[model samples]
Target chain A: MKKILRTHILLFLLFALLLPSCMNEPVMPPNTNEGNFEALWKIIDTRYCYLDYKNINWDSIHDVYKTRLATDTTEFEFFDLLGDMLAELKDGHVNLSSNFDRSRYWNWYTDYPSNFSGSLISSSRYLGKDYRVAGGFMYQKIANDSIGYIYYGSFSDGFSDTNMWYIMNYFIDCKGLIIDVRDNGGGSLESAEALASYFFKNDTVTGYIRHKIGDGHSDFSSPQEIVTKANKKIQWQRPLIVLSNRLSYSATNDFINRIKASPNALVIGDQTGGGGGLPFSSELPNGWSIRFSASPMFDRDMQHTEWGIQPDIIDSLKVADVERGYDTIIEKAIKIINQSN
Target chain B: MKKAGFLILIIFFNVSVYSQTRNADTYLLSNVANTFGFGAISVLDPYLSPLQYNGIGLKYDNDNLRFLDTEKLNLSRQSKFTITAAEALNPAFTSLMMLVGANYQYGMYYHFQPISDLKVLAGGSCDVDFAVKYLPRNTNNPVNMDMSTNLNISAMAFYKLKLLKRDVQLQLSLQSPLLGCMFVPQTGASYYELFLLGNLTDAFHFSSLHNKRGFQSRLLLHVPFKRSNWHVGFDFNMLKYSANGAVYKKDDFGLVVGTTFDMISFSGRKNLPPSNFKSITE
Candidate 1:
């Protein structure tokens, strides 16, 4: 019996020792143009989260794009071809980056009215010379001091709760506040959620998210709830206006989605630029990296927010007003905050 | 009755081993060794990238060994701790992945001597390992952590001989993990939604022999010297597991150089050192 046991033990040890040698190394394509094309296609075919959601015929698209490649295509030509094919997804978050250039699909906002004027917003009529700044927020009392106006240009810029405390204290005597997020292209989702939490009355299930679980386009795990807990130390109680435009995107879109659910909050201006899918990146055989939407985020109703969110009040920048150093959207926001007061 | 007889036979064997050895050899010393190794490593974590990465690794290990029961010379214990770090790049040299890890293991072995020149030991061990892998270029999935605790079966053999007018020992040992519990988040879940937002459900799973297998083995030749014994050998490690729809692989082999020395600790009983055994502390 002891001999039998010893033999089994020795066999197990031999098996363990041999397994690493027997296992296959990870297989990847070579670094040719065709190899890179195949690698990029497979990465998107297996990992991109929105193929089935968007009803995109990726395999058919592959056939279409492959035919466009020439026998002697230049490096720039190949880059352009890849960029054009990616534009088919119409995602602003997706990009193909290399040492020379980056390809971006800008139609998500470029097709809409340029409702934002950088010069006009920073003019004497708004966010004037003495406008107080806290982190990413540029604020001053407007509408004859009855309303507080804050222009937050980028979600990428980090802000602390202490900054929020000071901003709230400065607006303590005001009737309402206007948060202009007109051209705030998104950055960190944590920043967006943190900014939204100041307005939440309690811990709220702000949204749901689904992650890819398999190679199949529709293979996704069950929705995971995203809860935005109210800042236990402080909460916004008065009327809050979230102003957005076609340039507000990604994390900015998420910020508006969470805050719009607050009973005391209203979204105004043009519909937001949508970039609701979470982006993940991978590499091609030639070493160029590709960013694509790999996770889909949704509102509390489980509805996709990729097409941008509608506003409670739609307004646009009138060119005539911009010539006079005034922002029509800001004036409209002032009127609404005045009425709410 | 047969089971009771078997248990008695084991106890008798253990006691008889002690009676056969001299008291000076059984009751007075412990062995400790420190080893450092450098070699190439190959890693393939599908969650990090589809391509396998190959690069250099550095490791440092410390082992403490002693008799578990002084009177029972056949029973012994070993405690080991190790730290390792590696950096690897993709085939195109466009991306880099870095991994740093630490491991600890403790076990006991029952010895067997079929011949006067050789000794064999079989034992069980428990170990814990923690590691982190980072890919600087991958967005939203830049980092993945590895945390696991495992129970393992281990064995070793020692052969004593005379070479070049000096006594030398050749030793071989293997440790294989059988069962473990590990943490591997669902593939494709962004860190923003999982960790920052505090969603930890379904992130841990039980890993068994079918899903996880690995072994750490070393073969060394120890040469006696005046102050301490110096050894040189090969150190190899291989670990791979399937979890959360992702496969993680790591294999490495390196040259190891180290020294082994014996230690003695007394509880103020004033035990005198045995003849030919010098104590520098004294």
Candidate 2:
């Protein structure tokens, strides 16, 4: 009986000792920000699933951060540091949080209009081609003329080869082609090159990619080649008018730049979105990834289009024009083609 | 006739004494139980023996050590120690048991240094490591690798309830870490070092109730799968750290095997000598 009682006491003591340790609380670090972004950064550096890009400086980057925290006064500076740190990783798919409303940028883009002078045909089919309508940009043929009129919404669908080919084919037999790229927030660069190839008979240098090294800079040329097996035949040799606006970006702007360089293509729109650089992605220690622009792209003319691409013929739109449903830009293109005929 | 009656009374008294001893053995055997046991063996040197008599068992074993890859950043090795104890609160209610366990681990890593900063803005050239070779320009030469330490202490309390005729056991555990820390450089120059600090600084605490409910039945074959006289089981856990706010967790399970000895005798059977045979016993 004494031995059993002793054993029970020992078990009770063990439970008493362990019970307190089980309900432990997380310890908050002293004098630190509410969210520990620094700690998150380390986690990414060590355990990211993949590491393809090279040239990461661990010490100097840390030193600069410490210096920034010590000397910087406002939260904006800290945000800038975070943004710059993310940019150093040089990937294009990552993004970070911002105090500003990114939605406002999209709203501003959707409200903008194209600057072209051509009237679109009312036929359901365009040059014997059909298109799917989601939200913006409708293409159709009009009666009494073989001209194809297209209303472009945005540049987000640059990765779709079918859409690019459809637009190109619709203008094959038209007397004049009206291509719309207004209010397009740029997407894929390869898509831009694919669309531009339809207009070129020979191989051409599309643009240059600028990468940053320490304090210096280097350039790599983005070359475009014609897809030989894509039924290499030109059915459209008519005048081509491209529509643009101030909201067009990266790939969209590149498309405009390529068309402007060609002799047969005419751009008629407002200034395009000034973003012409490729983005880079960085992984944070906290297991979150961020993306930002790391390089700028330039045309064959050595012209930097970071401030937005200007159209050959500038035609701005007013709010009243949208309410009337009368596209003055399309009307002007039709008039020009009619006069030439 | 009187002599014969006296002999009969003596025999009856002796029989009563023997019955009393047998009853005491049955009562004690019913109250006492062997709940669980655990053991493990690792391939990494120096070898840690699984036997408890060698002073290297589940409670005190620390022979194999490896780096904890948290966020793939700070590479460090941790030494862990664990001890577990359990008991039945009520012998009458044999289905209920209480378990308590404690775990402590200490880790350390060598120092890391950052080399160069690549400007990603404007038309700048991104550093190509294969094409360039450069060293730190700072006065204090970057430490090739210096040792840094971290520690984690955890404890758990659980209540296990047996159900379905003791075939399944359900356990509810409250777990928490008492100590957690990571060493950071004074100058704060390396991102890898900063990454380590973020993961190790927070002590994790939580409560989980789990049913280790598995169907365990005696097989009617010659295989060892037949219900054995003794059974043992074990659980292992692993924690992974990530810098980008992600966490990784892993676990391993093991079982124990042995024979059990019966402690009670029937009414008319004689008390046998304790089995001293070890070699030929199997």
Candidate 3:
């Protein structure tokens, strides 16, 4: 009986000793205007990857934005103010979504010339109703039956294997394939990789991707290389011209970077809109949604492409050419194809 | 949290004197329970939202204990596994969050009997907990991952009595986490940064009373039948941890019903000790 009592006392004392060490301090700020402002500032300060690269003094930006936040500020006003603050990043992927409105920075494309004309492609360039639509691509023979023109408008769209195989077969007899990905704001990485795989004869290492492992700006994992091997079922061995414009972004930017590595591929048109970072979502205290780039992606040389990917041949649309119902970029691509052959 | 631990210890200490003896032939016992109840959840992730939600929870527990052969020094090894899922509602923004959690615990205890019908078990346990809470509507940050591994002190009391011409058993148990480590990203850190970039600073943190506190308690009742026992119970569990300026708290209480059975038992004169040789006629 004494032994049982002693054993019980010892166990009780063990837990009593542990009772003093368990209080934890709360980490989040209160849900007020000042608190929300600070939280937003901290979210970007810690999670946004481009602060150092973009050479923006985020501390000063916070100082400027905090002055705009008043106790009487309306929800829309606060939303606009936050949008203004994010605009400094000049990134298209950074967005603040609310029930009222969504904030976006579109200068990445709006400030540049619109090199693509949908009407011109439909009326004159796509062989005037002779083009066939297979999956997300509109393809036809151009340059008097010598060049294959394939216009892919968006990466958000998916295409089946059969669609791709048929498209490749249709272009099999052409001199070369002109792949136009203009105004494609990007979509699935799997789709992007699948499309890019066709240009390679062998396995290709196009770029690298790394995400945040900790809170520090410099805290990142070792870069994981992205490999896109050729799909032997319907590989494109002929000369390939990938046309891109300022609106080609995200996965489109990635496609351009990958295709640029292929020996038989050449990029033509304006520099692509850069959206190299993979975006993720979070929310503010006010229930407003926030989306920003979380992971950084790189090109084959491990260089950041968040700003934009430069084309091998820099060419802009000529107003006169548009008036004459011709695509300057497509014409240039056709010329290059003829010269290379 | 510490106050709660102290209260549990005091209650168990007072009940230790009435410990009852258990059948020497019993070796392995397995218990399983399924429960459902309502609880409250609070999350303070600056990237998500700062709101408290009330929701329903479903839980299940499986425990196994094997007693060692000893007279004065009675001992047992126990293993327990638990799964819980909860969905909460917040009227502030018409928002909701779903959390799914799983845990496993293993420990060894000293079993004691100070009276004819009461038994006390006390020991230390190590637990690993992993949970994920997801908000379907949050745009910027939609998910929070919760994970921790801790060493805890545990105590249990078992009481057996005859009621209505049938044998009944009642048991109460508590476990308090003492020390361990947890993973929590910084206030503004994203999983992309933590998982993809591999930035683990402040991610693996030491947990103690200052940064974490929680306890699990349960009261179970058993009614024996011909070959097995039908069990019914209530469980209350609370967990709270704060690190890198992010706070996570979960409180759950539910009614449980299950069954218990002995997996292996010693029988007859062959497995009995020589001291029981004359039990048939003496």
| Standalone chain B TM-score for every prediction | 0.84, 0.20, 0.77
Between candidates 1 and 2, the lDDT winner: 1
After aligning candidate 2 to the native by TM-score, how far in Å is the CA of A194 from where it should be?
1.1
List runs of model 2 lying over 4 Å from the truth. A1-95, A98-137, A152-172, A215-231, A318-323, B1-282
Native contacts recovered, in order, as a fraction for each?
Answer: 0.50, 0.00, 0.19
Over A80-193, each residue of candidate 2 has an lDDT whose tens digit, in order, gives: 666565555533222454433111123224445544223322223232245444233566654244777766555555334455567557556768777777656666555566
Alpha carbon lDDT of residue B204, candidate 2? 24
DockQ ranking from best candidate downward:
1, 3, 2
Docking class of 1: acceptable
What docking tier does model 2 reach? incorrect
Model 2 DockQ (Cα-based): 0.02
Q: Each candidate's TM vs. the true structure?
A: 0.89, 0.38, 0.76
